[model samples]
Target: MRRWILLAALWLSAVTPACAAPPAPPQRILFVGNSLTYYGNLPATFAALAQANGHAVEAEMILEGGATLSERLADGSVQTALAGRRPQVLVLQERGGDLLCLGGRQRCEQSQHALQGLAEAARAVQARVLVLGTYQANAQASAALVEKEAAAARQAGAEYVEISQTLADLSRHQPDLPWYAEDGMHPGPALTLLDAIKLHHALYGMPEARTLEIDAPRYGANSGLQAVLRRADAAAPNAGTPPHIHYEHAQVERLVRALDHAARATDPAPATPSSAH
Candidate 1:
């Protein structure tokens, strides 16, 4: 009787849903941001995501921890560095902090100018430029700002990836989710990388990992974005939200339309100069 019971228990355990492990996410990305973008070894997340999905991807981070676009713009050397990489995708998360926290519409105007420069630089190098919309501790960014940022990207003919709201929603549910570090101004490197991947997947339509582990790990899922998630989860906590992670459908559709317009404007054109992260 005891032997029979043991066999039955083992069988039940094998069939339990709890026994199934969640599949790892994909990764492979290039990220740009302030210190909030670097601290947590976000690059590692991308590496892990790639490996989990049987991909071996790399990431290049061009972030000036704690410094916003204003600082980077003042320095004026990122453009040169960007030219050398000619990355597949160039992500730009402007606003060192949140717009609301800064206390001025002037900053928003400044951000617009900086974005234009970023777009030109990216276009020069023929890289896809992604505008990262930031999240806040007090609350997510205003939909107006999201629209403005997306519009700015559209005008410059660049891609748009809004991550702030997604991270904010994640924070709300996973209360302990640390969107920013102790400074409350920057995203940990790990989280930054994760955001990069998630946004890319959303924009480029990431697929599931269906490649056989034995294959050369061809492009199955989004290598660029999944790598970001892997790095964040390993280096930082990944608190994901639902559909609203970025915005309501209406806002997302707007962004999508902007991206399409940008694509059309730049289509059949040669790459432009490389810009900073």
Candidate 2:
């Protein structure tokens, strides 16, 4: 009777299907910066890119035009966002030249202090912190700024991702490409696309080739994406408005490939020793 019972159980087990594990929750990333971080709707663009690559990701941002990290910190908006969202990753971007101490010692110190405070808050939530270094039109002039930003990132116990080198390389190869808006300081649509791709790579590593074939029309139709576009359009500095370029499916694929190549060519900045912790 025992042998018959065991045989019956084994038969039932063999015929029944095994239960599958539930899918993982999406990775939550928060971007904290100014117009440079928002132009061309970078957060939405990044989310779209991750979706294309089969990654479940949620990207959000807190941005104000010409606002530095210190100002944002003082305003308490960043803190409120951090508390409410509890994102897994926090990306910090300082206004142009502030990290380089170009705005005098007082301003530079304020920026650094703000960055450290923000980093601590992120760490408290067990979130990884990343410092995104911006680029200038003049690569030679921006080199010093990039180094300063990288050093600051390390001091704050965060990882640094510098896009200046990649942008410079692209400028050399694709001179006709519009990397800057009419203002010449802010990023245009092409540059914004590049930024999104690089951020995607930084957060999730190199994407597969198949993921580069994004459906541009469908991506543009996303409500979140449209909202960002409107924000960027309204925030254009002076007469320097972004062309608001829209890519076709084929164009998007090609542009993504080119941007990916550029990103791969320029290695990411060395991570801070504490970033691994």
RMSD of each: 16.0, 6.1
TM-score of each: 0.55, 0.77
User: How high is the lDDT of residue 254 in model 2?
Assistant: 57
lDDT of 2 by residue, 73-123 (tens): 787777777787788888888898888777799988999899999999889
Candidate 2 clash figure, as a count: 0
True-structure lDDT of candidate 1: 0.50
Per-residue error for 257 in candidate 1, Å, reads: 26
Error of 2 at 116 (Å): 0.8
